[model samples]
Target: MLEGTEAVLAAQLRRLLPHLDERQRRLVMGAAAGVLGRGGIRVVARAAGVVESTVSRGAGELDRGPELSGRVRAVGAGRKRLVEADPGLIPALLALVEPDQRGDPESPLRWTVKSTRNWPPS
Candidate 1:
């Protein structure tokens, strides 16, 4: 690509990236690189101020089709909630949050005294 074209792509990336979501940015950059053909990944990466690997990943995503549409990452990519792992955590946290609200006596957390450390009741 021409040196002037490199600057144009950089300007375009600057203007467009802020308006796009993470996935969209990657897709756009990937598309640009794909259209540019050989050596486009490095050029796009430099223009976008991101690692070449990010552009490469985007190109891979484009090749992978629309399976990842509308989502920045695959489903279940993040950490699970504490409440998910511990069913009794919510009641325990709620009891802690509202000291005056009596909790079920049978609950193991009923005997837990007030402590500085507490979680959100919601």
Candidate 2:
């Protein structure tokens, strides 16, 4: 009966993935995995195509109650912005956009005109 329930839950999660946001999906998977008890992380992770760590974190969140806001991902979640990830990125962009230097000819933005208001503040 447990195996049958796991299979059913896995199928439901797979079908629901496209419609639900990351947090919602994780919650559903975590809840289902929690119901299965022991070894549920591995089972649900395989079924959901997510890592065990993700399911583990989801389980942790479930235990902690509603901590997240309206957003799908938690605050400061996902990849860091390019500027934050690479200190050199802003300098490289500045060098390209500054006067007296030719920007990358291959860049699609090279042909497009942009207003100063649209540019990021230095």
Per-residue alpha-carbon lDDT of candidate 1 for residues 1-122, written as tens digits (9 for 90 to 100): 67587899999999999998878888899999999899999999999999999899889989999853567877897779998989999888776657654568677564445544664433
Stretches of candidate 2 exceeding 4 Å from the true structure: 1-6, 82-122
Instruction: Kindly list the per-residue Cα lDDT of model 2 for residues 1-122, writing each as its tens digit.
Output: 36476677668887998898788778877887798799988888988889988888888879999864567776777998888779899789867656543468666555334457866646
Number of clashes recorded per candidate: 0, 0
lDDT for position 23 in model 1: 84
Q: In candidate 1, list every pair of residues with a backbone clash.
A: none
Residue 67's lDDT in candidate 2:
69
In candidate 2, list every pair of residues with a backbone clash. none
lDDT score at residue 65, model 2, on the 0-100 scale: 95
For candidate 2, what is the lDDT? 0.78
Least well predicted 10-residue stretch by lDDT in candidate 2:
106-115
